[model samples]
Target: MLSLTKVCAGYGGFQALFEVSVEVEAGEAVAVIGPNGAGKTTLLRVISKLIGATSGEIRMQGASLARVPAHEVVSRGIAHVPENRRLFPRLTVEENLRMGAFPRAARKRYAERLEFVYGLFPRLEER
Candidate 1:
């Protein structure tokens, strides 16, 4: 589970998020919906440690992530896919999927995960 408390983040002096708080329970799906420049992406970036929180705190499974680095976020069981898919257009579908499984934990179960995903969307395998 992930929790954000009174998170305030911004670029320079322009505040994008102010006292924003959110919680995501295990096995639950949450969506961030808003208009352009609504700080949705900023919220995610802060959560993923791609950006830092100016105030408040973030916790995962009750552990504080105040000083966790961006590269270590995935190892902490947090994976972030930006709004931009950022897929390698020159690569094949399988290649792209493989590219996504770069984390050590995911790499160990690459085949299994690939099969599970392909089962969910057969078109991926066909592509």
Candidate 2:
């Protein structure tokens, strides 16, 4: 339910993205992998509206996202996990995990989500 079409974005005036496009449908997971200077982050920044696109469009649920801000994208159910783990050091493993599902409604489903994450890393369950 997410897609980008020929999206272009950049810092200052020089363009980092050129005609970039991607799509992720409901129940489908898409990954972006590339070397440095591939504009991976820039594309995400454009999709999430963290950075404005110079051209083209990003859409969610068939609605245009033109000129939307970064914070607004979360309402569309787009969660961008950071590159590095950003768990709170002062919190225990469980607490840190809890923080990741900070949305109150999302938190209601945390038990299932926790089990899913833990199953992927059983060692974490032991921790």
Candidate 3:
């Protein structure tokens, strides 16, 4: 469902990823394992369009995502949860989850998605 071909990305002059390639099929789970500063997060950021790829290509079902904007990425069915978990501290759990589904496409299925989440984590519903 997703493929990266020799993708390269970085912040300014500091290179974080160099020709990294990966492919994930439908219903398949893949893990990106590396030590500190291995560009794992950078790879994700590039895939989600949080940052641009310096070289190579990222394709979602053969559609190029190189020029896609960050906000539009979720609407394309790619969800990214950064390592820091940037949640609002003052917001309730439900509020935080609602914020996650802020994209128009996700919001359309808000009720169904919220119910699914509540079912998965009963404690979240209580919170």
Q: Best by lDDT, which number? A: 1
For every model shown, the clashing-pair count is 0, 1, 0
In candidate 1, residue 13 scores what lDDT? 91
Residue 30 Cα positional deviation in candidate 2, in Å, after optimal superposition: 1.9
User: What TM-score does model 2 achieve against the real structure?
Assistant: 0.82
Off by over 4 Å in 3: 79-87
Q: TM-score each candidate.
A: 0.87, 0.82, 0.82
* TM-score of candidate 1 against the unseen true structure: 0.87
lDDT string for model 1 (16-100, tens) is: 9999988899989898999999999899899989889999999999999998998898887776776477646688989978876
Query: For model 1, what is the alpha-carbon lDDT of residue 105?
Result: 81
Comparing 2 and 3 by lDDT, which wins?
A: 3
- lDDT order of candidates, best first? 1, 3, 2
Give me the runs in candidate 1 sitting further than 4 Å from their true place: 85-87
Instruction: Answer with 1 or 3, whichever has the higher lDDT.
Output: 1
Clashing pairs in 2: 1-25
